[model samples]
Target: MKRIMLIVSYNGANYCGWQKQNNAISIEEVINTKLKELLKEDICVIGASRTDAGVHAKGNVAVFDTETTIPPEKIAYALNARLPQDIRIQESREVRADFHPRYDKNNKKYSYRILNTKINVPIYNEYTMHASNYLDIELMKNAAQYIVGEHDFKSFCAANTGVKTTVREVYSLEITKNNNDIITIEITGNGFLYNMVRIIVGTLIQVGTGKIKPEYVAEIIAAKDRSKAGPTAKAKGLTLEEIYY
Candidate 1:
């Protein structure tokens, strides 16, 4: 058997999430179904991340072992022919037999987008979180500074997460705005707890809206209480931007 790694991207609006579920469709399920059809064997994909419902991905990674004679470099082209337009396999290659996408990830980057304008653009409605009010970009930037280091991110994670430790290292965090009134918050980290990116975006939005002081971010982190953080941002506005191994 040969292990093949695939780089994938998808618009998550139409699927439940990345993982296979009992009553819903998923990206992994679709990929596996197509792989089975193409290779004439049952296949299961191992994804780098289990992104939540409505969350998109630009550079998600997955791996599967197969015994087919097909070359690894041809897998992307073969899979793309079967995948829907909303999902695409960007690249594929053979990997060392022991390489596991999730366990071997060196870092991951996520980005959350906000449409901070009076009117929402029809074209981008599915991709951005619309906020009618003007946001204080400076305050959001200030709040982001507090998140750029190793910390126990209990306040930012979803309650009931099975992980025993909430500590993660934030390599970088930045907020930027464009002329089209689109605000993007990009964060790179060693790892993230469940719902961590959405919570961070929500807290930053509170800071931008003056509901929370920028300095309070540090306090919230120190408190290690979920209730102290802002609400979780909408999943549709969040995307897994990249993964490094």
Candidate 2:
């Protein structure tokens, strides 16, 4: 059997999450089923990231072992034809037989989007989190400086995460606003705890809205208390932009 890696993109509005569940549909379940039908073999994909429900992805990664004779490069074409329009395989190729999508070392980039306006824009409602108040991006950027390094991110992680450790390294955090009244918070990190990125964005939103001072971010990190941080941002605003192996 050869290991094939797939770069998957999905809307994520209709599925529960990346992982398979008993009662709900998921990206993993859908892909696994389609792959079984196409290859006529039992197939299971190991995903690199278990993105939460309502979270979109541009290039999420998954690896599956298959015995089919189809060329790895052409697998994407065949898979796309069978996949729903909301879910597509951007690319596919053979990978090292021993490579494991979840255990392999990798860094990820995620972005959170906000529609910052007095009125919500219907066209972008599904993909963006709507915020009525005007956001001060400069304040958010200033606050982000405290988060752009390795730290015990317990304050940003969600409760009952069940992870062994909350320590992770963040490479960078950038906040920018465009003319369309869209605010984007892009973060690159070696790893993240559950709801970590969304919590970070929520804390930054507090900073932007003057609810929390920019300097207070350091205090929150030092505290390492989940209750000390802001609320977790809506999942719909977050996207798994890329994973670098």
Candidate 3:
């Protein structure tokens, strides 16, 4: 059997999450079902990242072993024909049979989008978080700088994540606003704990609103207490932007 790696993109609005679950549809379940139909074999894909429900992905990776004679490069087109419009296989290629997408990952980048408007913009509601308060991007950027290097990210992780360790390395963090007033917070890191990105964004929002000073972020990180940070941002605003191997 040969392992094929697939680059998947999906709109997470209709699925429970990337992982399969009983009594609910998921991006993974759908992909598995479609692959089974296409290859006439039970195919299960191991995703590089198990993104949470309502979290979209632009370049999530997955790998599955198959015995079919189909060309690797053409699998994307064949799979797209079977997948729903909301989920597309961007690319497919052969990989070493031992390559594990999750374990082989180098780093990933996530983007949290905020629609900074007094009134909700219905058109962008599904993908962007609507924020009524004015967020000072410059202050947010200043706060982001404090967490740029390797450190224990316990303050940004979920309260009960149950991970083996809370330490992680953040390569970069950027908060920017476009002309349309949509604020985008992009963070790149070696790995992330559950809800880490969301918590960081929430804490940065506090700084933007003058509730927390930019320089105070260093203290929050040093505290390493979940309660010391701001509220976790909603999942809808967060997207798995890219994964690098």
List clashing residue pairs in candidate 1.
Answer: none
State in Å the error of residue 19, model 3. 0.4
Residues 67-174, candidate 1, lDDT per residue (tens digit)?
999999998999999999999999999999999999985799999999998888878877899988789999999999999999999999999999979999999998
Stretch of 10 with least lDDT, candidate 1: 118-127
Question: What would the per-residue lDDT of candidate 3 be over residues 65-176, giving only the tens digit for each residue?
Answer: 9999999999999999999999999999999999998988579999999999889989998799999999999999989889899999999999888889999999999888
Model 3 stretches with alpha carbons more than 4 Å out:
none
All candidates: TM-score: 0.98, 0.99, 0.98
Error of 1 at 149 (Å): 0.4
Clashes of each: 0, 0, 0
Model 2, span 155-188: residue lDDT tens: 9998888988899999999988899999999999
Query: Relative to the true structure, how large is the alpha-carbon lDDT of every model?
Result: 0.95, 0.94, 0.93
- TM-score for candidate 3, residues paired by index: 0.98
lDDT of 3 at 168: 97
Taking all chains together, the TM-score of candidate 1 against the true structure is 0.98
RMSD of 1: 0.7
* Candidate 2 Cα misplacement greater than 4 A, ranges: none
